[model samples]
Target chain A: MKSNLELVNDCDQFPPNRDPSFLYRFMVNGFDCPFGYLLEATVNTFSWPDYWEINHDGKTVKLLGSSLEERNKQIHDTLLAERERGSFKILKGWTSEIFSVYGPQKDLVLSIPRIAAPLFGIVTYGVQLLAYQSDTSDGAIRIWIARRAKTKRTYPSMLDSTVGGSLPTGETPFECLIRESAEEASFPEELTRTKAKACGTVNYVCRTDERGGGELGLFTPEVQFTYEMELPKDVIPTPGDNEAEEITLMRVEQIKSALGKGEFTPANGCIVLDFFIRHGIINFENEKDYIEISSRLHRTHAFPTA
Target chain B: MKSNLELVNDCDQFPPNRDPSFLYRFMVNGFDCPFGYLLEATVNTFSWPDYWEINHDGKTVKLLGSSLEERNKQIHDTLLAERERGSFKILKGWTSEIFSVYGPQKDLVLSIPRIAAPLFGIVTYGVQLLAYQSDTSDGAIRIWIARRAKTKRTYPSMLDSTVGGSLPTGETPFECLIRESAEEASFPEELTRTKAKACGTVNYVCRTDERGGGELGLFTPEVQFTYEMELPKDVIPTPGDNEAEEITLMRVEQIKSALGKGEFTPANGCIVLDFFIRHGIINFENEKDYIEISSRLHRTHAFPTA
Candidate 1:
């Protein structure tokens, strides 16, 4: 069986040999607020737009649009042009939904198309909720697991958390969790609002490879605000949207088996492992990599966060 | 009120201006396994014992003793001599207990006196248990807080976790927690063993200043195996030993106020802040530094851990 640490390593693949010189810092507001990294190749070959400035000496790239709306339009036009030229396959999954980019002081710098985030090596945010039921008699816990629809663009047909979604530009994590709960799993809004407990966050710096269905070698630092909801026994979750194909309640052992067999999405695997650690299921006594796994789940990002 | 992040920064004072060249890597078994960092001043000025080798060119230091016993003895004798000379104030609080030093692959390389751990800039392990009670009707949570004895050497009369103790060389975290739970709080072994849940770990790299009651400018990277226990309302904790002078149950708001006022021990403050975050008392929407605090609580240590 694959160790929990191994499962974590599979997702948090920040290249160890990454060279700072080979990547350009994504600066905002004329300050040294670096929030993303852009590959040298992209900097050299991509068609130059008037609003983007590349500084060779400083190894930095900045948007020169003077205002948020102007910057957003500049990026949108650039990506649209790139899509027409078929320059990057990742742009094929264009998510018009914008993701807010924050500066070093947690100020909203600008918003860009969601799919374009990885190209700029920007940090993204999401929310995930693990809904479970407790059998009070024996104290056995069963979790509700969802399988992504085969038609989904990313990680299609993969096992996922019961309720998970990306945080749109202005939405808070809790708000996203509530919306995802109803939209993805048909979970009641009142039940989720009252019962969902915001536990903590899970952070990892991942690089997209071919397996991730993106342009390879792009950094995607993510912060996931995690939550847990103890569902009542009488409540059942069904597929509320086409995003999920099915929902099933699995015992802890079954979940562990699935995790060991690498059946879950990489990030979801990390979220579930974190859940196991917090609930005392996988602890220092039994898990040799308990310390390493716990620390690795919350890696300190090199760049500023929202 | 001090921000939670500011409270965290108080305990995790890893010198931002730390010059790595001024520190020597502690090697083991002829490998470049750097488990600790020793200041160059200590290397150049201290009396050289035959068992310790300083490689100036490689910027490394190693224990030349052939066996674990020999290595342990070498460290013990050196510390004893230093204590006699009154060379380091940290040696005054020397506990006879030994802490295991691990290599890069997590193998036990040697054992050193507990108090001498910071002298070598080694990573130390401890277990902290936060005992709490939940009101069934209103769902209000209250925590049991401990106050150290006024005569204690380190942070005397300061607030502390309900049960906490260092991990001796040969003991696991859980084993240490169980022993400390009974010895420190007069808590029953059965209740602890059955109810204590190993939630996760909190890690930080701190440097001792005058306020910490140790030799100034010594590095202390620590890993705390944190636990949570829901105590029965009828059960009360009394001082089982002189380490803790008194124990009292404080509501969550009271604990937060204490944390804001910096009444708890620095490390204990971090542990309590972690508890608040995990229990949803401190969350993303309400706290501005939610992501930063969550990630900082589990800082990635720069050395190997056992």
Candidate 2:
């Protein structure tokens, strides 16, 4: 058995870890503070109440205590005082913390870093479509697919769902999906709860063109919550030009096949597909073409376990 | 189930949370760069990163980003690039985070928050001492009760295992326990792997403090790890002033009875004692005096059920 340090260090030694363009860079960092938005920060090492003075542009902020006792004491006192006074402070301040709009922020691929500080950051949430092609000639399950405009800052020329965004501060998993759906695809709020299929959070991290030492921008750990909104046979994806350029209705198999073939670099969408396949949202096993193309797109290999 | 907004708005409605006067308070507010020194500061809820902007002079440092995402992204990018380049850039500045140290600066209370952060900050790990008064009157199995100090912040003036800290950042469960033991009791390193017992993480939140709101610091989410240390009859607890002030030996029955009577304040320890009694670490049934006293201490109800 390896020491925790050894194991973490070894995992860190893996090369793909250093890749700045890696889509899931931040996932390696553990834990997160789920505020309205996800936060990725490092819990400072050392006992609490332990202070380290950092010199910024000058004015000194005394970094103070670390002991849990001290913290709990303050809380206890504050609560007690508030109880006696029958009044407590309501915290409110507009922070200059950096936040990014995901799902085609610019004309290029965009993503948030997974870890920073100690325990805070952002995560991406996306809806995964699972509409399949009906055998009936006139039976085509209308599925919405939004395309990334070439001018996007990150993940340029990629495909993604209509409703997706970086989770907002203090938004729950379900709320984020609903908000993204309305913003990106203009999906009706009614459809949010009706057809809203919460797949799961796909944990990943990535960097953006906004470079700082090429250092990873610690965003909230992203977990794309895939929601399936089954559309009428004629309903189509009408992506807002500001966020997306094209709306295409392809057979779910085609999307899967393209993804498997590595034809589309939908960084976050791949995991959503995993959810779809795992949850039987889209069945491809029986479709020979879909399976073949998928194998070609995503060359998955399974090794026998002895 | 209530909505998230409702939950957040109603958070204050719940008996106020315990922030306590631990060193982490200073760090939590924005003490940049950590070093070894106890800091003293007040606990206040600032929007996540906003706390970083707070100056020691009580002036808010101007933050670079306007939102959490922006701030986190910038920090993440910088860290990653630095890591990739194998050079850590000193964030050029200081956030006046304060903390205070009590007792021996060596190893006082195990820095559990640092450890718990990595473990999702939602889990608990604890150990229980099963002490007994064996038939060997000539030579009793001297149970080394790793005594906790009274004045040491957080659960000050209470009893805790000498070797218990929350799992630290980048530490495994066993590693945390081992580190706690070595730091607190100066237990041999080898003993970490040897006779040291792991009681496992307790999955619960404790609002056991009764400080009311006078201090604004009381609640603590703890994951306790209990260990049974067999002390040589001659070796009594000679606690260092910082972590533990004294080591008092209570008969097994005293502890069990204390637990039964709910006399113990930081109820987590009481639970551990009960576990110890049940496991024979402490023979409550046999040690009538211990039971009598401990029962007096058992002031609260049984382990709270939600």
Candidate 3:
């Protein structure tokens, strides 16, 4: 009997009838437990170093790399070749180069393609800012949204928030918000750091890179720290980088229609839902799952048990 | 592999080395699918009636009662007897005589013991209101908190919010708030119905009532709609009933200290945490799990598909 919380979290995203044994916990040093899972097929082909143990008896494999440097280099090259081979399309410009290695208490940042994260079931974090007009005579909220450039390998030309980007290694979520605002929207640091209120986040997991086929892919879990920044009535976002095709202000109703049409990234839709709830645009009486949807956006697996 | 959402929702409340099969789904009429799971031991004993079938092949059971009235009565009597037999301890004053039957769409209300809900894995909803000072000089918030009456059946003498109650049969949540506020805190209707803003909810499932012995209990899933009401600095909460021994104003720091000492009920602790996050008292930078905790309070299983 799974908890209601777990059932909601599951979202029926996993393929039914999948064998649990097909995946093994991807354990890192000092984690005592796995942060994520690695496919058994991948493990069978790994030429482990003498120090690393393939503990089949314990029904678990240990990545006792000769050193952190050695492990990073191998995982990096392996995933990079897979990407170059067209195994999984990587979103250019939007890609996070520094991947996170989650330990028991703290996380380690290594220079690796973010697209390669799921191989070890490692987690990722990002920032999505909802820049909007603060005053509207009609009591309607208008948000500045961007459309990803068509050149993007994934979700190209999809609608996104005013500003968004993956969290670079060693940057705080707030700092990332400031940097991303400047890169994506050409916003000044003062307006972003001062007026951008830290709202919350929307998180979910997706089964990634199925190019290896049946029962083989990386599990990518993500957490995005969200912000709500007010834009001066006359201010408009001009793209500072080529990542966005266009940035424009749209009424909440228009955005809602776009969401219904699936014009936004699934994650972006969830963030807008959070936005509606926070801005008093949605209430429990109107949406039965209002509470459920609001809370589900913030579930954190950033720290997995050992 | 579960979605990161479900993984975060799980929070692994179960004991180590626990068997997943110990739990079974709790289905209702037309819900053909599982609402949640009950302990397997409870299901093996039911000589299910004609309309209902125990689908051992699917490793689940179905509840297809002829009518809500009939099903409600059966589950009610069966659980009441279990309680009388001392299978588990009942909270003295907090027993819910009215039971809730949630289907795919709307929920049905029936007269049944609320405490018996977990035995069948039913999910319940309640309203909790936070009455606070309208103005604060130091930006330090003060709230009106109540201490439960010592003579109450469940969680006697524990700390609670200013006003809280189960949603009565046929009452809207807002109506329930107005009603409960008057009943619990002698709050004025005009003040509550007009000023009390529905914030959101905090949801979780816990295995309470340790009839299985030593850490094992029936899982109770709950969703509480939280509210924030502003009170003039001169106003005070006078208990309208015996539910609380005292209702007094306490600084947020005092509540935090009480939470640290475990003086508040487990559920109240969660409600307060939600309050802190919403009020901007807790920030993502300060609390590592702040965003995670903030979002998890609202995961709902209301619309489980058949």
Q: Which candidate has the highest lDDT of all?
A: 1
Best by DockQ: 1
Tens digits of per-residue lDDT for model 3, B82-116 = 55555544422235566565555555633446655
**What tens-digit string does per-residue lDDT give for candidate 2 at A178-294?**
666666666677766566544322333333223222223333223344445556555445664467777677665676665554444334344434434333343222322222111
Order of quality (DockQ): 1, 3, 2
Flag the better candidate by lDDT, 1 or 2: 1
TM-score of chain B of each: 0.93, 0.47, 0.81
Alpha carbon lDDT of each predicted model? 0.86, 0.36, 0.66
- Better structure of 1 and 2 per DockQ: 1
Task: Output the number of the TM-score-best candidate.
Answer: 1
Classify candidate 1 by CAPRI docking class.
high
Model 3 interface CAPRI class: acceptable
lDDT of 2 by residue, B1-306 (tens): 332112222212121122222433222222232212122222232222432444545422333544445544543443344335533112122122211111122122112222111111122333333222333465433334444466554546555544455443344445655565656666566755565543322222343223322223222334333445454455434453377665566655555454454334343444444344323343322333322212221211111111
Worst 10-residue lDDT window, candidate 3 chain B: B3-12
For residues A143-173, what per-residue lDDT tens digits would candidate 1 score against the true structure? 9999999998778888999989999988889
